[model samples]
Target: MTHLTLALDAMGGDVGPCVTVPAALQALASNPGLHLLLVGDPAALHPLLAKVDSALLSRLEIVPAESVIASDARPSQAIRASRGTSMRIALELIKTGRAQACVSAGNTGALIGLAKLLLKPLEGIDRPALVTVLPHQQQGKTVVLDLGANVECDSAQLVQFAVMGSVMAEEVLSLRNPRVALLNIGEEETKGLAAIRDAAAQLKNTPSINYIGYLEGNELLTGKTDVMVCDGFVGNVTLKTMEGVVRMFLSLLKSSSTDVGRKAKQAWWLTLIGRFIQRRLAKRFGHLNPDQYNGACLLGLRGTVIKSHGAANQRAFAVAIEQAMQAVQRQLPDRIAARLKTVLPKSD
Candidate 1:
């Protein structure tokens, strides 16, 4: 495999250098051909670098940055005051042709704001949408978009998201004629907001996309459709809810095991059955672990930008870097731009 260079906003995450540096090192170890440009205060990163193997040190380079955008920073504040922040510098590496892609576990609003301002939107894209892969029941993955980037979207914008997301599913997920759907309260044509209905109508008429009409929230991970399109507010809420549910189940599984352990001494057979059930649940829910699906790509941008979960651990953060590498390798932005030219409405 050819080597790919990626820029990391080492100061963006909640734990800052502690998480980002180790994640970068892990990514480098996993992909021998991968090189990382770590952007942050050298003083904070140097100690971590010392722990890395000398051979790998050559593959990792630190780019000094003076500031960082807080996770709670508003978009406006980030744009106006974060010119020299690690996130901005990492993005600049992409514009300068020094890095193939950039990954950040920073403020979502700030990352979106800076990415659009610095990289600009792809031609024919009104705005970029946050897209991520979700594990599907068919032992496959679905590409869901507008994952908290645009809180509200017009009908045309929703249609545009469908177009971009379909292309992404085809190009990245390698799904041929990937099915598309609008997320709504109900699957009926008359249900949902006018924007969703209008977008559905547009998708149904559009010959290029495999629009499967509206899909209710229940069908999200069933592999019923390859792409789920919705406004950011709804998409974000749905994603977070699913994540919360997964966490809840996993927590319950852990607690149940402990409760069963004490009773095991009293009733060996019952404890054995309980342990069996716990193991099965763990195996099943392990697939839905958010860490495995940590990276969310910002689609329709001029260059590749991946947003990792802000609270991600090192292993999870490495997945985000890998996501960026995949996008760069596939030329995702160019592919979306080409597809949009043919499918997007004339007004756009």
Candidate 2:
């Protein structure tokens, strides 16, 4: 509900304006002080907003975009042709102080390339990371980084991720001395790749970091570690796999609910109890819904930029907008920059 402004790449995602328009309207309705700049092709976006209340429409503006970057386009190629595109214009809004933050469910690689070039990396940081919190079984959250940014990272780059992830956990998640761990094949000291082992060694010696040793894939949601670090290839696969499992589980739940409704049609009391149980189950597993965690904050940039899943639905895209809102409110980049001074080695 804070007085926040954001730019949305309305023509970026798979469903484009159909999803973004509804999400934007939902966000505006919830936050009275929020203003949004929707960047996309005006001809496509105008019809979507045709029926919105004039007063609400006053807080929203459409910045015409001439083109769009294909979801499968290479990052390098997209940058060359990025001018006037919805995603690029959204980033430009942030760079020019027209918006506090930007959210895009566009091509991940293109978004990263454009953001790093426009926003620039923070001082002492070279490789920016994609960070987002994952809900644990015990209701605690863990900050994981390098979601899909750098596929193959060296020891030094991994260490940088550790530092950034640690700062993210502490400053953004409000946790103290967040336990940091490298995602590996095993928990032993000598397990996994040389780069990961070396990063673990460096983190162990760094007094500023609370290195808790290596974390295996199965232990990610155990609530044992506060920050999980891994290369983008592994991180991306892990995140997608987990999201797929969650979606599968939720789909099964829905199917079961429908079957129950059909069987209880003749018995009103049975139907009533079934609905009650279904509601309870939904509320219990609501936090685990993959849609709620669709947005991944692209950390280490000078300004806030959130990368939503390309296939994100209306609810998922709305969640991404809210993530951008929080990142801007918390001033995540400035805080991470300040913390880097203490954690980053001086020789670099």
Candidate 3:
């Protein structure tokens, strides 16, 4: 029997339980074996469910949690100060073995801090990473790791991320011998800072991963590299910038017409060509839609903590729930743990 149970932080996002309640229903429709324990004020959730269809309401279980963490609260302070906050309670469900994974579209820092403190990292792993998927030119998507987890890392950590990310691509996406690359300024060996150089050397030496040497930032969308590894700082900036650029391009394409009367004439032409092209590109290479990859598996944690965008819409929220179900069914955390042991720097 598949013991798939999910703990959701119902009060974390902007829309709160209102959006989350409906999303839970959508997830249930898509995945029958899935079970959910919603952690938040029961009073708030009852009304939300009342608004939802009866079919979905039957699949949910509301676990009342009084305390709530404000978006601006510091992760450490909030987790410690409010024991009953939805985020903390959701973590407890995983720790207590009531749920296989926890999902929160709330504060990023709070989620990271709570995960590290509650679950701890696997042996020999120094830091956990947040990874996401991006469209590849080869008709699919590639996984990018450490998008915003450990900003500073040693050579060993970088090599480990390569191994972890590669396994994810292979196991999750079914890619064979997924090509791994160290994100660098240039493809050349001697192009980046000392940190990048040393990290590249370590990845090349690592036996478990198929390290394909340095990859420039532009190569990420080319589908040439299956997994791109970088420090959290660089990865976060790159992910956001790529998302921003895609959005800006779409905006310009939509409003290409300038004049009032002439605008109507040009709008039709732009709609027929430019608009069509922009929509396709955005679907393939853009990041404005959080629903594209709803939840980020907090890799390296003892248990899974799937993080979602705090402002996630219903679609994005549903994606997060679906991702949680997938991770549990696939044993992603256990797979990552076993894989990491192979490449962990052996103690003398």
Candidate 1 lDDT (Cα, whole model)?
0.91
lDDT of 3 by residue, 1-348 (tens): 364789999998877887887888888877777788999999888877776766666667898899788888886787678688899899989999999999998888888888888888877677788987777767777889898888887777787788779878987788898999989899888898787799888777777788899888889889888999999999989988887776676666545523322445656665466556655766654554435776777888788888887778888899888777777777877888888778776533
Residue 165 lDDT in candidate 3: 91
Tens-digit per-residue lDDT, 1-348, candidate 1: 698999999999889889999899888988989999999999999988876788899999999999999999788978899878999999999999999999999999999999999999977788899999999898999999899999989998898899989988998889999999999998778998999988888888899999999888899999999999999999999999999998898998878876786666758777777778788888988889989899999998899999999999999999999999999999999999889889985543
| Candidate 2 deviant stretches above 4 angstroms | 260-266, 346-348
Q: What is the lDDT of residue 288 in candidate 3?
A: 46
Model 1 lowest lDDT segment of ten: 257-266
TM-score of 1: 0.96
Output the lDDT of residue 169, model 2.
Answer: 86
Instruction: Quantify how close model 2 is to the true structure by its C-alpha RMSD in Å.
Output: 1.6
Clashing residue pairs in candidate 1 are none
RMSD of 1: 1.6
Instruction: Show where candidate 1 strays beyond 4 Å.
Output: 266-277, 346-348
- Clashes in each model (backbone N, CA, C under 3 Å)? 0, 0, 0
- The per-prediction CA RMSD against the true structure, in angstroms, equals 1.6, 1.6, 3.0
> What lDDT does the true structure give each of the candidates?
0.91, 0.90, 0.81
lDDT of 2 by residue, 283-325 (tens): 8888989888889999988999999889999999999999999
lDDT at residue 342 of model 1 (Cα atoms)? 93
Which prediction has the highest TM-score against the true structure?
1
